[model samples]
Target chain A: MPKEVAIIGVGYAGFRALTPEVSYKELMYEAAVKAYEDAGVDPRRDIESFVTVAEDFTEGTSIFDEYVPDQLGAVLKPVHTISGEGLHGFIAAYLQVLTGAMDIVAVEAHSKASNILTPDEIMAFAMDPVYNRPLRANPHFIAGLEMNRYLCETGTTREQCALVVAKNKHNALYNPLAAYGASIAVEDVLESEMVSYPLSRLDMSPRADGAIVMVLAARERAEELSDIPIWIRGVGWCNDSFSLENRDWTNAIYAARAAEMAYRMAGIRTPWQELDFAEIDDTFSYKELQHMEALRLCRPGEAGLLVEDGATEIGGEFPVNPSGGSLGMGHLLDASGLARLLEVVLQLRGEAGQHQLSDVETGLAFGWRGLPTTSGAAVILSN
Target chain B: MALLEKVDKNIEARAWQGEIPIQSRYTCGLAGEKFFREIMENGRFAGTHCAECEYTYVPPTIYCERCFAKLDEWVEVGPEGTVQSFTVLLVAPDGTPLEEPDILALIQLDGADSVLVHRLGKVGLDELAIGMRVKAVFKPKKEREGSILDIVHFVPVNA
Candidate 1:
């Protein structure tokens, strides 16, 4: 059997709209210091390896991994970067410790979204240059197209999609760290200026700046360090076709495959029963509902119904995105997955102060590499 | 020693605004050359057929996604297609309102299993529907340049 890995320490800084005072490096240093302190390990000695999740395009720097070492106190040590989601970085760290090559590893991810002046242009740059870019429409239109298909095929409604925005933004009201927390209604969401048909501006999660650092260790080392270590039961990631010409528009096949791999590894047959709650990707409102079905938390088209029944509310049976998700906390670029994972750890550790769910044990966190890409990662964590 | 204090004002912070000085050229690789050349020369849609998968791909690829078979069978796809999905763009990526709301659709040409992302013209958002029959409207042959823009837009066949 593979050795188990657990997150013994987690730290984060600035889930806010802007942070002009401190640079991205300072953001990393602040979060790293707290995470190392929380785990009671000195980075130079106890931490054996480092993994960071970043995209050079978002960072406006080439080979962003070079700039991370100094801030993370990982200078000259074994360090690498995963260009995908932060949870993917977690999996890399987890596998490293499982290999027994490293007893302790630190995983870091952050968003300096405020630094990027043209967010949409950056997203548009990710499209197929020869084919899609020449058309020159906003990238969010892809989400809108998918939303139209998902709603049409699944019989989900625009009102149901709006409920997701209302629920997550309301849930964010309880999270002090959340950036865009607000108490709004579904009708308000529907009334927001339409960016694309069936997708109003409110349906999309705004950008936020933040950093998160997590320290993982082998079970033996984890138990020695902390009384309550959040065990990583399973982790899975997948990528569907990158081409828009041939890809599933209605279903998130990538999320389903990722979730399947995670569920099989964690030996979870019926996810809605085995897992207490989830922090699903809510980059767009419809995405939350689409991902719920993809995660097998509900049947196709039933995710919107679950929201209607309050089954996904903080006090509800499944309680997804109680930490306000990316919608409430602000989409943290590449760090978004780490933010989701951090909430799971906090809830599992009973550190989620106000919005904490009762008697929760197992929780899930998921991430999608935002628009125009079908890359996704899923992880199951238990206290 | 104390830590460095924070910079408070936007005027006080020193920063430079410049874009990366790099130009990139991407080749569509094995299949794209044939696909675009056919469009440039004939103003007709061409797709590659995979015998194993028994599916034709528009904006054809050299390899079959499902069976990993080398796809070289060229077939005439369509000047006619069906709308698979569509969206009306109200704003540009820079958050500027478009001159007119552009209707973009993913169209599955009659002979191909895969879809092509393109614009729809001469149709209102209310009139457009998934599965609506549409036909490609190419630019005048004199202006054809082996690019996707060679086809001006797709329009509802009935209209």
Candidate 2:
């Protein structure tokens, strides 16, 4: 049997719209220091492997991995990068520990979204050159198209989608790390400026600058370091077609397949009953509803109804995104998934002060590489 | 004792424009070559079909997604299709509004399994709806460049 992995320490810095006072390196260093202090282990001494999650286009630099080690103190160690989201980085570290090749691993992911002057242009560069790119519409229109299809196929209404924005922003009121928190009604969301048909300004996640570094270790090392270690019960990731034309826009197939793999590994037969809460991708308001159905927390077309009935609120039965999610916390790009994972860890440990749900032992966190890409990841955690 | 006690104004902030000076050339291999050639020469859209899986791919693929079988059969899809989903973009990528907002739609061609994304013209948002029949408006034969833009835009069938 493979050795079990546990997240012993978690640290983060700068959950804000912009961090012009410090560079991305400094942002990472701050998070690393907190992580090392919390884990009671130094990277130079204990960590045998290091993984950083980043995308080159988002960073505007080629071979971005070369610049990561010095800040995290992983210099001259086994360091690699995953050109995807933070959950993928955590999975990499988990695999390293499971192999017994490394006793302790450090995983880091950060987003300096403010540094990029034209994020939409960078997203466009990632699109199909001949087919999608030449149209020159805003990259976010892809979300609008998907939202329209999802709403139609699932029988979900625009009012039900607006409730997601209302709830998440309200939940963010108690979360200190949330940058875009507000207490607004569904009417306010409907009144917000329409960016694309079926999607309004309030429906989208705002960009934020932040860094998260987590310490993962085998069960043996984890026990020695921290009294409370959040065990990584299962992890799975999937990628559908690279072309948008061939994708299932009405449903998040990548998320569904990834969730199936994870649920099977975690021995979770009934996800809704077994998992306490979820932190899912709400890059757009409709996505929260879509991901819930995709993750099988609710039946198809039932996610919106569940939200409308207060089943996804903090005090509700499912209690989704009690951390405010990307909707309220502000999106951290590659770091978004880790931010969700961080909330689950804190909630599981009873360390989440104000936003903490009652009697939570297990939770799920998910991430999607935003727009025009059919890729996703899911992680299951238990206290 | 405190850090940055002696920091000056000039040293406090600096910004630079970083640019990646590189050009990329992507070749649309064997399948794309056949698909685009048909559009350019015959003014018709072609899809690759996997006989075993009975799946017809638009923006034709070299192999079947489900069966993984080689798709050697090319089938004519549509000069007309239905609007699967659509969006009205009030602003461009640079956040500036055009004189008229652009209506973009995902057109599900008549014979293809997948939808093609393109702009819609000769219709307003009120007139656009899912399942509305629309036809691709190709540019004049002389102006065709074997590109997606060769078809100027999709418009309502009656228009």
Candidate 3:
């Protein structure tokens, strides 16, 4: 078996609908400072590698990695970028630690989503230029169609999907970092103006600006470095078909395959029974249920019933997304997965203040690359 | 930390907004060249067949995604297909509400194992259903440009 890796420290800055005051670089620096301080490590001296997750189109700049080093305290150091979700970056850092190439590595991801003006256009640009982009349709249409298919095939209702919005946003009320916390009912989600058929504006996670940095170390160093280290029990990522036509619309096969790989690594055969909670992707209301099934937290079509029964609430059995998730915290673009992992870490350390669950030992964090892509990553963490 | 010190309340951060000018032309690859040519010249659809997988890919590619077979077999699919899934768009890419909603569907072209995403035409949002048969409506021959758009839209065929 490979050497174990543990998240020794985590820090975040900002989780708001807007952050006009801080530039993206400032966001990274703030999170980096907090992370380094929490880990009690001087980046220039202790950390051996750094990874930042970002995309050129999302950042409105080419070679986005060129801008990361300075803010991350990685200047003149070995640093790299992963044009993938934040958890993918975390997984990369984890693998680096496992390889014995680095004892301590830092993973950084942030969403200056507030900085994006043409958000939908940027998403559209990610489509097949020859086949799909020419249609000039808003990219969320893909999510809409997927939601439609998922609901139809699984017998999950639109109201059941709306309940996810209500549950997550309601849970966010306890999270100080959450931006879109609300006490709205399912009707509010149902009544929200439709952006695409069966997908309402409220059902989608609004954008937020935030940064998160995590320090991971080999097990020995992890034990020596921190009082509360969350062990990375398993990490897995997978990419399904890039062609939308070839994908399983009803199922997040990417998430399922990623979870299977992760569960195998963690020696977890029954995720719903083995894990205490999950902070999976909920970029859209229906996605929460779809991911729930994909993660095998519950049987297919049963996720909707679980939400309706409040079994996934913060105090409920096997509570999921107690940190408010993207729905409550606002989607942080590529950084969304890191935000999810941050919550699991905080909760594992008994540091999640208001929304903390009782007697929780293990948690899961999953991320989807979002529309026009079938890539996903999953990580299992235990204290 | 020195770089992130709080600026005075009155200080306006100096920043400029600008757009980068970029231009490029995309080459429809080996498979796309054949696929689009068939649409433009013959007003038909073609897919590459992978004998090993016994699967046909619409909007064909040179290599099979499943078994990594070099696909040299070309098969005609459909000008007619069944709607696999669909959505009605209420907003444009720019977030502006469209004057009239547009419907888009993933059509499983007959004879091909894969689907193609295209616009749905002559159908109301209330009337569209999954598994509904639809036929391609192509633009005039002279206007055909060897593009996916050569097929104007897919309209519902007789039940």
Who wins the DockQ comparison?
3
Clashing pairs in 1: none
User: What is the Å distance of residue A326 in model 3 from its true position?
Assistant: 0.6
Q: Rank the candidates by DockQ, best first.
A: 3, 1, 2
DockQ score, prediction 3 = 0.63
Q: Positional deviation of A22 in candidate 3, in angstroms?
A: 1.7
Error of 3 at A62 (Å): 1.3
- lDDT of each candidate versus the true structure: 0.91, 0.90, 0.91
Q: Candidate 1 DockQ category? A: medium
**Which of the CAPRI classes, incorrect, acceptable, medium or high, describes model 3?**
medium
- Write model 2 residue lDDT over A1-383, tens digit each, in one string: 13388999988998999787778888898899889888989889999999999998888899998989999999999999999879988999999999889999999999999999878888878889988887888877898888998998999998999999999999999999999999999999889989887899899989999999999999999998999998988899999887879888788999999999899889998999999999999999999999999999999999999999999999999999999999899999989999999999999999988998999999999999887788899999999
For DockQ, candidate 2 versus 3, the one ahead is: 3
Where is model 3 more than 4 Å wrong at Cα?
A: A1-3, B1-4, B7-14
lDDT of 1 by residue, B8-124 (tens): 887776666667666898887768788888888888888999998889998988889989988889999988999999999899879787878988899999999999999999997
The digit string of per-residue lDDT tens for model 1 on A163-224 reads 99999999999999999999998889999998988789999999999999999999999999
Candidate 2: which stretches are off by over 4 Å? A1-3, B1-11
Clashing pairs in 2: none
Rate residue B127 of model 2 by lDDT. 94
